[model samples]
Target: MQKTRLSASGAGLLALGLLAGLSAPAFAQEQAMDKLKSMRVSGIDPNLPLIPQTGKNADAIKENLKRVKMPAGFAIDLYAIVPDARHMAVAPSTNMLFVGTRKSSVWAVTNRNSGDAATEVKQFAPSLKFTQPNGVCWTKDGFLIVAEHNRILSFPAAEFFYEGADVAVSEVVPQGKLIPVEDESYNHGARVCRVGKDGMLYVALGQPFNVPPREKLKAFTEQGIGGIIRLDPFTGAKREVYASGIRNSVGIEFNPKNNDLWFTDNQTDGMGDEIPSGEINRATKKGQFFGYPYIQGKTRITEYGYDKDPVPANTTNPEVYTEAHAADLGLTFYTGDKFPAKYRGGIFSAQHGSWNRTTPIGARILFTSLKADGSADKTEVFADGWLDPKTRQYRGRPVDVANLPDGSILVSDDFAGAIYRITYTGI
Candidate 1:
């Protein structure tokens, strides 16, 4: 929809518009070079610091830890202090925690399994320069997969070789071509990746627009922008679109039971405080389209899905919706037995909070439960209080979450440049 009015708080919204820049252009002549030019855009540089970084002591973390609220028998503690931490993946075999960011490096959190905060944190592949390598996944075979702004890389036995510069990285998808150049823009370049049950790699490509311009729609559709694309992990061949019309999705997971896909989507902004809510969607089959630039949440984008053009008949609505502008980011299904019985098989999502609203919403962890039939039944706040309700100041912003092998959950906060572990000990 058209946003005719902009408020004072809209500055943050505008900043998001700028940071989210980085849409792919159509693959055509000079596209590769155009991709390079676009990558060097002033504000969206890989070297530029995206989040505030500072020293956080245990005393300070312990003080702020009092602010968090959770269910009985559940508690939260600082897990590790990871700078600019975003998406995370827990290695299946080694159980190492690999963190991704929108800057120049990736991180590994170690000594977490012991009864302590992480004793050590190190950068993965310190020798190689990374560019917004914000999407990460640990494969079933003890490998680490990373998706960058312009390419995808896989590191075999990443943990063992992470200490030295001799680490070998195999390029899964060559850089500068993941997103088309003709449609390239400035926003939404941080990708989230996962290996589905089918042994294919699925990566999220958020269309870089509040509402896509008409000229860009064709290219977005053709290049699989604003959708999830799957390819054979070994050959990077046999590519196909798994979902479409997603504005910008930063989190994705597969239900271990049915092997269906689930993702969290950030909704359109500047629509006031509560018009379009962020979403958690379930894709039961291939080629499903979750409406964007057309349908938003359960409501249609008034300006676009009318007149000659209309909302697609097959648009699938989100199974769950958070408060408007919650900026939901990463999510994982609770397959661990660490928590209470009720939490098993439920979905845990992180809401990155709102920037455009005068009254902020969602800088916390959320839970969505399913009925026996597997349809999403309800969504509720699981943990909160990161944002001070009194001063409206944020001490931290929850960006993404990864469930640990020990039954705890790792919550990443870019604002505070740290990660926190939440565990249940029983009252």
Candidate 2:
């Protein structure tokens, strides 16, 4: 069951913000609707629900799988089961998928044929001590980069195929420095990192917490310690800030058409279940601030009460907003011809659902069509039903999404510890 309520104050604040920019009422209405569309709510039940233990009966696993929802012509099939998996990456050239687990190890899953099951699954790196492998990316040179808690590890793709009891091709390229956590707030820094089209490695270092003070923010922004940072993969030369004022951006990707970078950011918690929705923003230029701690979606609601210090009026707003606490994660653009023509350049984002809201939201994948100018026109649910509103329980939690070589979309569910492949077959 789903409940709907209107926050007139929120709407009024949005309308006022729009009016300050545009005089036309029609345009303001459109902008207001856009803002509303981005607001999401989840975790209506404040009490922490018990997560079913793994290795339960098949019936129990099947019951938990109910969180996933798919369209009519598409079917969801399990591609692999990885226990404690959080983030993953795939190499199209080698037909291999590398999954990063929370257990400080990386696993490589390979399929002999595209249509067949994964013929082999093995741990590629075992000596690595990771609090959690939060991000993984494959370079064009067949090197797999894994983002550990405070370091980056690289391994050759051929190490999996080399039959040996002990293969040692893994190398530590960069040892990450922990962004100082000001307060006792959560500071899990490992998010998304990828090699950009400019031949530079970009990593998103999330803020220390939901909202920090101005001094902390200044330190993070000026030093390129928070938000996104660009570095040389070989020399580790740090350069400009990709984007700033971001809370917790767990996923990032590059648009294939323009090579522009984009990310999904989870907003501050405890602001009801719908005030500050998660966001999707494009890194169009260096030092682009998305207005965190000061404003959310153009509204000035500072969690740390630092609004007295003037923030720039032109801080970039998100291209698209998701429901609050939806926990939007990995994002990708569909460049394959596997789906219909409409999905050609659209964006697919995985919503990891919510942990703090009273009403549950997210737990699905969403599609948004990007206009020629790189702004989203409209967003809609491509997949859903991950949470049972009646029971206030979840079947699965989607964490990431990727497109395969054959144009199919693959969604990774971190909660159920499985990856689902969705293929479209028109009637």
Best by TM-score: 1
Question: Could you give candidate 1's per-residue lDDT for residues 244-280 as a string of tens digits?
Answer: 9898999999988898899989888777888787889
- For model 1, the stretches where C-alpha displacement exceeds 4 angstroms are 1-56, 303-308
| Clash count per candidate | 18, 17
Which 10-residue span in candidate 2 carries the lowest summed lDDT? Answer: 40-49
Estimate every model's Cα lDDT from 0 to 1.
0.80, 0.70
Global lDDT of model 1 = 0.80
The numbered model that scores best in lDDT is 1
Q: What is the lDDT for 250 in model 1?
A: 93
lDDT of 2 by residue, 358-425 (tens): 87787888998989887788899998877788987777888888877878877887687767778888
